[model samples]
Structure formats: structure tokens, C-alpha cells
Target: MYYVNQNQINKRLEFLNWLVETIPESLENKPESDKAILFLAQERILHLALESVTDIGSYIIDGFLMRDASSYEDIIEILHGEKVFPSHLLETLLGLVKMRKKLVQEYFHLDRNEIYPLLHELPTTLSEFSNSISNYLKHELNT
Candidate 1:
């Protein structure tokens, strides 16, 4: 039997919830002079949010004895295989996984223009991710 750590999952979900709530406000209404600082800050937040997502997914996979994930992309793939989220979300989640890699490995070379558009989608994507995990957990636990 797989042992799901409800508390651990919920804690991560709470953090994800915080990240989703923080993204929109962080992206908007910034002073022109502060653009550089804002970009860096947003970059860090997005990185953290993406990290939290993978962390939560990994936790659930381990708890449920799902197939081992060989990479960050695999983590999303495994969750998708289990129907944790809809098919439409699979590509977006995979893109975020790739973005996480870019944030970590290519930080210095990142283009603000390229990243800025994605930031606009962060809140909605993160919210969808969090909700999917929460719903999956609720169903698994109750079953």
C-alpha cells in the first residue's frame, strides 16, 4: 500500500498557493526605472514557483509508489500518465519544467523580453497545477 503524506503535500500546496497569488501583483505596476530589479525578482519568484511544483509532484509520486521520474520532464509526464491533470495542461507543465531548467542553468543570458510574456501566464498555470494536485490528493485519499 502506498502511504501518502498528506501534511507534506498540503504544506507544499500552501506554498504554491502563495506563489500563485504573488505572481500577478509582482508583474504589474512597476516603476520604469525599476525594470531591471523587477525582472530579477520576478525571475527568482518564477523559479521558486516552478521548483515548488516539481517538489510537490515528486512527493506525491513517491508517496503513491508511482514510476520513478528520471528527470524534471519525467516528473510531469508521470503525473500526466496518472491523469492528475487534463491533456491540455500537459504541454504547459512540460514548458514550465523547461523554463525551470533555463532559470537555473542560463540565468545570466536570459532575455527579459522572452521571459516577461511567460510571467503573465505564471499565476494561472501555477493555480491550475496546485488545484490539480489538490484534487488528485483528495480523490486518492478518499478512495
Candidate 2:
């Protein structure tokens, strides 16, 4: 039996949704670069979104899966092992983890173009994550 932290998961999902709502229709329309404040806001939002992703994984692995995963990829893999996450998301989540590392450690002089598409689709990815968790739990509860 798994003991899930639905509240925390939902809260993280909510925040991600909020961030998504704040994003403009297209990043392509912006100037080659953003103004100082715009850059700051985008960076902050990315940081929080990435942080929430890790936190959600931690909550599940620690609270329900009861496993200690040493790294971000490991966390995802462990959850996958438990049939909690689909295999298709493995590549994207791993990429997100790498991007998070880059954002945290090498954010200075980073290229926005590379990150633009990821930012654009972040909401959908996050929503998929939330839905995956909800569906997994529902299936477990039913079984």
C-alpha cells in the first residue's frame, strides 16, 4: 500500500499552473532579449518550476515509495520501477533535470533560445505529471 501526499502534489501542480498562466502566448514575439526585470521574472519562474518538480518526486519517493534515490534521474527511475510513471516521460524528465542543473549552476550567460520551447511547453508537461500521479493513485486505490 502506498501512502501518498496528495496535498503537496496538488499545491505544486497549482503553482506550476500559475506559472503557465503568467507565460505569454509566444516567446517568439519578445525582443531578442528581455529587459532586466523580464529576465529576472523568467529566471525566477523557471527556478521555482524546476524546484517544484524535484519536490514532487521527493514527496512521493520518500513518503509513499519509501525509497532513497540519490539523484533526480534515479528518483524518476524508481518511480517508473513502481509503475507510477510511464516510460515515455523518462527522457523528458531527465532532460528537465539536466536543465535544472544548468539553470542552477551555469545560469550566467545562458542562451534563452535553447530554453524557449521548454518554457513554452512546461505547462503541458507539468499537467501531464499531475495527471499521471492522480491516475496512478486512483488505480492503486481501486485495486
Best by TM-score: 1
Each model's Cα RMSD: 1.4, 2.7
- lDDT tens digits by residue: candidate 2, 1-143: 66677788778877877776776643435575655556666666677777777888888787675579998777777877887777777666666666776688888977766666667766676677767877876786673
What's model 2's lDDT at 25?
43
Best prediction by lDDT: 1
Model 2 regions lying over 4 Å from their true place = 25-28, 31-36
- C-alpha-based local distance difference test score of model 1: 0.83
TM-score result, candidate 1: 0.92
Candidate 1 local lDDT, 103-138, one digit each (tens): 888988887786777778777777888888888988
The 10-residue segment of model 2 with minimum total lDDT is 25-34
- Itemize residue pairs with steric clashes in candidate 1: none
Residue 92 in model 2: shift from native, Å?
1.9
